[model samples]
Every structure is written in structure tokens, then in C-alpha cells.
Target: MHPESEDDSLQRHRLHPSSLLFSFLGQAKQFFLPFLLLFFAAGDSWELWFALLIIPVLVFDTYRFLTMRYRFAPAELIVTGGVLTKNERHVPYARIQNIDLKQGPIQRLLEVAEVRIETASGAEPEAIFKVLSLSAVQRMRGRVFAERGEARPEDADEASAGRTEPAPRPELINSLGPKDLILLGLNPGRGMGVVAVLWGLAWQMGLFDGALNFESILKFFTGSEEGSVLGYSALALGFLVSLFLLSITWHFLRLFDYRLELRGDDFLSQGGLFTRHSTTIPRQRIQLISISESPLQRWMQRVSVKVETAGGTGQPAESRHWFAPLIHRHELQGILTTIDPHLQIEQASWQSLAPGYRYRMHKLSVIIALGIAAICQLIFWPWGWLSLIGLLPLFAWATQVESKYIAYARTGYGILFRNGAFWRQMSLTMNEKVQVVSQHQSPFDRGHRMASLRVDTAGAGQSGHKINVPYLPTARADELQADLVAAAGRGEFSW
Candidate 1:
């Protein structure tokens, strides 16, 4: 009921001139090509109609551009559009998960940045913003973060203001030199063999049929039959080798300009060759820390570390969104300790399930393998024995890997679930985030007081990471369930 604060008033409205121009230009660009094609293809009679159509479009765009304005209320940002229908939108700042700035080649030439704000709520324009000057963009970013009650450290502000000289940037943190890049590239996952195989399969399946231009290769490789065959084979080999090299080169390049800087309670990671990307993640948002070791990496005693965060595209393509793709495992413990000293992870104690449970799981794998083998025999009788032989090793491997990697760690704050065969995964989340916990007892498991405990968390996608503790004492599962329910009731994440 009191007067509004100055900060509140300052964020009350935003009028981005560049955004209006961007919107108009984007629409104009889209129509321009079609308009040009139509103008050339159509007769003069149709020209009048085109002109008439263009007039209204131009007028409507101009009117919309002139009227566009955004206002920020205490809880949300409001946008109203349309000279007639009057569409309105309310975007809550608290629900905003990410804010990104994009600039295409044309925008770069114009020296304007487009701001995109994405929210947790399911809404179109989950990201909505306008183009603005780089300086204005920076100011707006500061304001948005400020509204969220997260401001840069006092030292950073003072340094920026020239009240105190900025501290020298640490050479190692800011710049990953050629040697560091080489080391990173030498890591096992940098190899492109798997990618190549996938690409080859896609090609064989005719996925690239539409895009293929056979004439170009034919013109280049045409010669005597034997010579042509040799030349084509050599070319294919070279292409594959180049693809492998390119993957390594790209990995190295991504690390080349890598920079991680601390700004208050958050960390900023910035790096890219062609399209520079910068992400700021608050220390508290991290949900889990995982380390993975490939066959080659395990031999070398090296592994990749990743941190899972809340919300965003949980895809490898958007690796930076949910996880930092490549960090040495040895350094993982140190990083987690630095982020949250309270996090504790001990080696999981092996709790063997009932003998019947293991036997059933093993039988299930054998059954699947046998089914696949029978199908292959019907269709490929000549290669049936080989197919069955190949599947035998796979089934054996699956059983062994599952048995070896199956483990769970109980920490003060959360439970750690670890599992995998070819690729290992570990997840940790606080008790309060747990939405549901259930114990499943198969007929076999019921016979020996053994059951799988599945814990589910919120904000995770449809298939959230569910932990299955193969076998736990019923009392332990009940105790954990009670603790989780209490934490949820208190609306807190407790250790």
C-alpha cells in the first residue's frame, strides 16, 4: 500500500526502438523475396492488387511498430500489441529461466542485439524481447538480474567504476592456450568414429537422398573404371579421416577461447569460435555432479565431469544449458567442493538383491537376446549362427555391466543413483525436490524382502531421472520416504 520503490519504477516500462525496427525488418525481409517473385511472374493487372495488398501490410506494420511498448509490474513484464485485437502478455520475471542475446550477420552490421527472455511457464514468447544497443543490452541485463535480487559483487562494481583497479585476470582461467586445447583434444571422446558410423547409417538409409548432388562427385572422379574405383575409395577414406580430424579440431577450438570467471555467487562461461555464447549459472541451481569414463579414458585414468542444472533444453546439442560438457574427473571433486562444501559423496555400499531377483533380470536379457536371434534366423538363415553368437557376448556384457555399476550413495542432503553399461550416469537431488517415492516388489523380489526403490524429482522432463536402488532394507526406504515427505512439507531442501 506504500509508495513503490525506485527500482520498481525504473523497471516499470521498456521501449526498445531497435526491437521495433527489428520486428519490421524481419517481416519486411520475409515478404520481400515473395513479393519480388510475384511482381516478376504476374502480369500488370495483378500489380495493382499486389500494390493494394502491400499498402495495408506496410501501414499495419508501421502502426504496430509505433505502438509497441513493454511495462514491468512488480511481479511480471507486460506486453500489449495490435492496433485492433489488442493482444496482451504477462511474463513473470521470477519464472524466467534464461535470457539470451542474439545477433545475426545483418544485426551485427547494424550493431544491435536482440534480447530473448524464456520462462518456466508454458507460454509462447517464453522468450520475447527487442533489439537494443550493446550498451543498452548490458544495462538491461544488469537490471533483469537486479530484479531477481542477484547483483554483481561490490568489488566488481567498484572495479568497473574505477574506484579500485580491477584485479589482474588469471591467465590460466581466462585463456586456454594451445597446450591445454591439445590435451583436451587428446581425450577419448573427441574421436568421431561413433559419429561417422551414425552418419554412414543415415546415408545408407537414403536420409540424405534429397540433399545429395551425385553429379558433382561423378564429374570429379570420372576416369578409367579401375582408376575411378581407386580414386573414389581414396577420396572416401580421406573424407572419413578428415571428419575425424575435424571433430578433434572443433573440440580444441571450443576450449581455445574458454573463459570461466566468478561474478558474485554465479559463474560465467564464455567461449565459441563463430558464434560466441555466454552462460551465467547461479551456484545454488546445480542439481547434480557426474563423472563418466569411456573405455579408453578409464585406461588413462581420466574422465569427463558434468553438472546438471534445472530447466532448459536437456539435450547434448544444448550441452551448456544443462551441463558443462568437458572437465577432467580428477578436478570434479574440487569443483563441487568449491561450489558447495556441504555436499558429501561416499562410495556406494553394495546391497545385494535376492538371488531370485538377479536370476530373473538375467533371464529377461537372455529371453530378449533369444527372441532377436530367432527373428534374425528367419530372415537371414545363412548369417543366423553369427547373429546369435554376436548377441551372446552382448547379453553377457549387459548382465556384467549392470551388476558392476549398480550402486547407491546416501548423503546428508540427498541420495546418489549411479548406473549404466557403456555410458555411466549419476544423479543427486535434495529431498524436497523429490515428488514421489515408490517401492516395487516383483513376485521374485517379494519372496526375499527385496524391492526396487524409485525416487522422482520435479521440474525434470516427462521422463525425469528416476533412481532405482536395486535392493534396500524396507525400513531404510521407509525412513528416507518419511524424511523426504517432511522436507517437502517444510518447503525446504535439507541435508
Candidate 2:
């Protein structure tokens, strides 16, 4: 037989030697706090015991590095490793949904990356090659796509020859400029979440111990015991300004130079300021698409697009599920059509909820308002009663306005559901992607002869969006569920 070529040799090789360093760092990062605690608990001569403890860790790492091996077959990837208990896994290329790569400063310098291969079977990645050479990663990507018959021209070269030419520019589907990123920051204003994290960290570090308190902050904002409204108003304004500034900064750092591209059968998103990040979503694997607009986003005539597939949930920022982080409102249909020609949201005939839906909402709102007002009165007395008056009228007006916009539609290919008052979200699920069709009625719904319909697909819960239509006439809900079930049955589900 002829000598095995370099590419063939790579097919059965172990991970690069750098894997040992990364594996050790990963272990240290995970157990640093625990080990530190133990170090202190062990007293002054803790160094000896600490060093002894680490010997076992070093031995385990060495054993793991020596034993672990992977092979690329024509149809599947075979990974085998473990010392005490040998383990092997065969991951078929067709079942793979995502192959995400991460490169921090050091990894980039070393021309290596941490690769996570995901499939629809579970929440976590199916295979994680902690560290691999850049060339190896390229070959892996090429082989995966090639085996699935979705490989681009360059993918074939990288897979077979372990070399690639300069890539042709991909089709730009959508991109976020500075203005769009700013708007995204303003609308989502996600930076407020950082305040809690910072506060926790500060508390843990003893920075807040006897240094700051809620009472002091209240006094600073309100001034004298009388609690001046102007002072509190100023404090509120300052707080909001801080949140907005933080949000803008956070967005810039995480999503700087964001762009979404369509190359062959894949959707690629790339962004980040310090460490570049990218995510790839295969076109055919998309199970659900959602368009959402917050009150601020709507006012600005902007919306965000997100998609879900069978794989990946609670992923890191680099592997997020956003299809288009932000896009102009008018571009919604155009973008949808570009993603898939079959999507026609504007053409679908929408149907509002059943009659008395508003009445039901108003009744529930009154009960909630009364309960809140009673609890407040017990705590704050006179002024608390005023809340009920305000809440009742507010709820009445909200229910009236929101009931008009809450609706669902049976599109030719899938189901579309839209709801929300201040923050509206519309979601579409193709019939072929639907995994389950469910109908239910609560006591209140039964009283009004109403029911709810929910269509679930893979990654449904992970998307933070669902096709659940409420307050439909029981008959309509039943009819919709049956129709959806029939349609789903007709089309074979793809990953």
C-alpha cells in the first residue's frame, strides 16, 4: 500500500500537545476557589499538601492526554478516551447541528481554538475538542459539511488537501452599524443586569461592608425626612442615565462590528470588539423564527430577529441564537424572504382572540389590582389605597388596547402567533418543524368556553418564544390543533 498522506494521517491523530496546557488551565479555573479554601484551612505549611494534591491532577491530565484519540470516518466522527473506564462516542455528521469555535488571546496567538460540536439530541454540546490547531479545525468543518452534502467549494479543498484558498465574499444578509447597536442598547437596556452582579461581587469583596446601605442611599436621594419629590426625581433620572450608558457600553464591547452573512446553505454572524466571535446556522436546520419589538424599538421602527434549531440552548455569547440582532421594521419581510422564500408573514390572514377575551382579562386585572392594593395598604396605609384607583383604570385601558393586537394566523406552511402589549413578539413555526400540538383549558377558560393552543418544536423553550395562542374558542382551538397535527404528519421533520 502507498504511504498514508498527511491528510489521511490527520484523520486518526490525537489532539495537539497544547491540549494539555488548556486542559490543566480549565481544571485549575474550575477548582481554584475550592483549593484556595483548602490551602488556608490546612494552615501555614499548606504548600506541601497543595503540591501533593496537584500531583494526582498532573498524573490524571497526562494519562488523559496520552489515551484520548479521535478518528474521522467517512460518515461519522469517532472519539475514544478515558483511563479507568474506557468510553467511545460516534457522532454522525448528518446529526450535527453546529460546530462552534472559540479563540481567546492566547489561543489565537498559538493558532488554536476550542471547538464545540453540537447535535439536537441534548442541551449540551455532543463533543468538545478543548484545543486543536486552526488547520485541524478547518478540516473538521470541511469534513462535517462535505459529509452532509452542504460543503462550499473551499470546504472540499480544506477537507481533502488540508489547504484552502482565499474565500470569496459571502452575501451580506444584514449588518448592524453603530446606530443600530446604540438603538439595541437603548431598547433592551440589558446593562441593568450588571448592577446586580457588581453588587454581589462588591458584597463578597467586603467593599460594601459598613460602607453603603439602602437607608443611606434613600436619604441621599430624598434629602430631609420630608422626602422631597424633586430630590428623588433627580436621583431617579441619574439612575436611568447610568443604566443607559452602561447598556450602550456593554453592547459596543460585545457586538462591535456585527454582521450577518449568507454563504451557501449557512447563515454566519460575526462580531465582538476584543475577541472576534462567530456563529453559523445552517439554513435547512432552522425550526422557528421570531420577530420581536420592544416599546422603544417599535417607536424607532426597529425590530430584532432570532431563530431556533434543534441544538444549542443557554450557549455562550459567541454561540447565541440571534439571526439578525437588529433590523429596520420595513426590512422584516425582505429579510424573512431572504432567509426562506416560503415565509410570508404579511400575506397571512390574522384572526383575533375569541369574544369576551377582553372581559376575562379585565376581570383578572381587577383581582390582581385588588390583591396588590390590599397588601400595600397594610404596609403603607393611606397612599397605598390610591394605587388601586390608578391600577384599575390602567389595567382597563391596557386590556382594551392589547386585546386588539393579540391574534394568531394559520399560514399556508406554518402557524404564526403574536401577542404582548408593551413588548410585542411574533413567532412562526413551519409545519415540518412542529414536534407536538397541544390544546388545554383552565377553569377560567372552561367557564368562558375558551381554550389555548400551543405548538412546540425542537429548541422551543430555549428560544424564549412559543407559538401559544390563548383565549381561542374551544372549538377553534381543537380545529387548529387537529389541522396542525395533520400538516406536521405530512411533512418529515428535519434537524
Candidate 3:
């Protein structure tokens, strides 16, 4: 009668029938571009070969669908399958980190979703269910969380029985409509990436085979001896405008109808235009939160917020959670409160970098600018010396403005850091979540009696932001490091 006893006695269940279709489609996507290339470039003679390739893929998918079997157990999920080797995996509920769900347009139409089971072990999901009935996924989710003590027994019972019970009312934290998405798209990032992708795609399609010419491009920029600089300037401006528009469209489409909600101890987000994604993160799993603003966003008085959680290191940038893609500056505090009460950065007593940091920043910028100017002079002699006219002032403003904003602080619940001038970012890592605290000193730092402090938490990718506070007085850095190490020792890391 109990859900536990029922699960313990249950037999292994096969994947939903639609899984065969979904698996076949997944394989088809991988070959679609190749098939197109064969048809367009290699001609109809290769059609038979392409069909032959599909035959093996179809057979593989069919065999996998038929062989795969999964079932719920008292304390773990057991998955078994394989052709000859006959592999089996038992994943304990306590070790499960994330249970993510995805549904494409077709899957949504068929009332099925793809499920990814993640753990703290690696970047890839521990297990993936290609296509499962929505009801089955709900049941699995409830069971998993229930075993972890995060869900009620009655909820698990209801889910296991496949009842159409009313869903819980989750409080809406933020919702991004078309206007908000447009605002997010207007942010000054992702343009170069979009341009690069489009250029690559065009190259693959051979759109530039005969139309592009390096010499012609040089001539266009150089123009006649009395070249039309105005004409080339307009052309460059048009290209940049096109790139910006493309970036906007990419962001808009990728995050269409985005919504964030709070359901008890979990933060849930669902978005995407073509393929909807639903991510559930337990509040305790969150490691760090970052709020960032670019020059354009600063002018608009807006900011973007994101969260880093434990596990899944090396995942793509899009896989990271966006707490608020774009929100007004005034709304940040309220959102932070909903995320956690201890993230009150505005109220924290912020500490400025070492007194010599400004001098250090200026010295570094001067060295870089002088190096650039020297290289320019080597190439353009007379005109290159004139580079200091532009470089000096630009570097001066950058160093001075950046030194003014770079700071670190200790919050009631975490350590907070603020850095950058052009693309400013503020990061907060909770004291309890801190895993490692380190201090480093270089020859340059020693010359100025300065050092850098770094705090590492779980799931922090090398490419992503973490709590690294540079340009601190050696004594100050030592003091902060000691405090953080003690705090980390006082609390236990859940993951």
C-alpha cells in the first residue's frame, strides 16, 4: 500500500513507444546536414549510400528501445540494458543532483518530455531518458525528491498513481515577455558570436565561393588614391548594424516566453521558443550568484543576473541558469531577497582594494599601451607615434574608472566581489558553500605589497566567473583568507 513497498516490488518498465521515434529523429538530425551535402554537392548517385547509412541507425535505435529497461527501487533508480555486455547502473537518490526536463514542439504535441538525470560526478548527465510520457516524468520526479526528503509522501503517492491532481501554485518571481526579451537582446554581447556562426554557416553552404575576393575587400577599404572614405565607412557601419540585429534575434528566439518561479524550496525556470526547457534547482544547491551590466545596459539602468549551481562542470554557457536575463536596477534587491536573505549586497560594508591598486592598474595599462604604440610605430613609423594621442587618454580613463569600482566585501551570508569597468560584474558566494580559499602573490604584487584572494566553490567552470578578488593588500588578503577558511570549516558542504 505504501509507495516505497510498491516501488520496491515493481517490475522493470520499458521506455514509452514514442522513444523509438524520438531516438530515430535524434539520429536523423546528426545526418541531416551530411545528407543535404551529399544531395547538393555529390549528386543523386550518393542517395543510395545515404539510405544505407540510415538503415544501420534505424536498426540501432530500434534495438536500443527494445532492450532498455528502467525501474524505481526503494533507495535508488536501476537502469539496465545492453546488447552483449549487458550493462546496469544503480543511481542512489541521495546522489542525484539535477532532474532537468526538456520538450520540443513535437514532444510537447505528443505529451512527452526528455529527462536528464545529473549528479556531482561530471559534465554529462548521469542518465538520459530520450522520451517519456509527461505523467511518468512527473512520477519519477516526485519519487526522486521524496526519497531525498524534499517532497511529501502524499505527493509521491499521487504522482505514482497517475492521478490528474491540481498542481501546486508556484509564486511567480519574474516573467520575460517580448519587451523584456527585446531589452535583453539589446544588451551589447553575443553580436560577435552570432556573426561568427553565420559566417561559418555561409562558408559551409559555399555562399562565398566566387562572390568573395580578398583583393577586392582590400581595395574597397583602401578605395581609389583619392578613395571614398565616407562610402567605406557607411558600408562598415551597415555590417555592424546587421550583426547587432542578428544577435538580438538570436537572443530573443532563444529565451522566448521565459519565466522564473519559486515553488517551496526549489527555483523553477521554463523558456525557449523552439524547444522548451524546464529546470528545477533546489535552493540549497545554489553555489554562487552573479549580477552583471555592460555599458549599454548601464545606460539603460538595467542588469542581468545568473546563478551557478553544484555539478555539471564544463557545460556550455547557455546551459547556465539566468535568474533574470534583464531587469531594472531597482528590482535587483527584491529578486535577491527571493533567492536568499543573506545576499544583501547593497547593505554590506564594502572594502576597497589596496591603496596602491590604482597605481598598479595605471602601471599595467601604461605598459600595455606603450607596447601597442611601439608595435604600431614599428609598422607605420611616423603615424604610429601618433597612436599615443588616442591610446594614452583611453588607457587613462579605463584604469582610473576601473580602480574606482573594484571592491570586495564580506556579507552576512557570503563573500561578495565587484570588478570590471566596461562590463562590470558582482559575484556572491555563500560562506557555507565555500569549498576552497586561496591567496597568491606574484613578483609584481610583492613589489607593491599586494596580493590576490580567490574563493572556489562547486561547479565553477574555468571560463565562468568565480570569487577572485585581486589587488588586495597582502595583510588584508591574508586576513580575509583566514576568515573564509575558518567559515568554510564551520559549515559542511552538502555536495
Q: Which candidate number has the best TM-score?
A: 3
User: Per-residue alpha-carbon lDDT of model 2 for 24-50, expressed as tens digits?
Assistant: 887888778877777777766745466
Once fitted onto the true fold, the runs of candidate 1 whose alpha carbons sit more than 4 angstroms away are 1-16, 28-63, 71-82, 85-93, 105-111, 123-127, 149-258, 288-291, 296-322, 346-361, 371-381, 440-450, 462-480, 490-495
lDDT of each: 0.58, 0.78, 0.80
Candidate 1 yields a Cα-based lDDT of 0.58
Clashing pairs in 1: none
Q: Could you tell me how far off, in angstroms, the CA of residue 331 lies in candidate 3 after the best superposition?
A: 2.0
Candidate 2, run of 10 with poorest lDDT? 1-10
Query: If both were scored by lDDT, which would come out higher, candidate 1 or candidate 3?
Result: 3
- Each prediction's Cα RMSD? 5.9, 4.4, 4.3
Q: Model 2: what TM-score?
A: 0.87
User: Which model, 2 or 3, shows the larger TM-score?
Assistant: 3
Compared with the true structure, what per-residue lDDT tens digits does model 3 show for residues 16-43? 8999988888888988888877888767
Model 2: lDDT to the true structure = 0.78
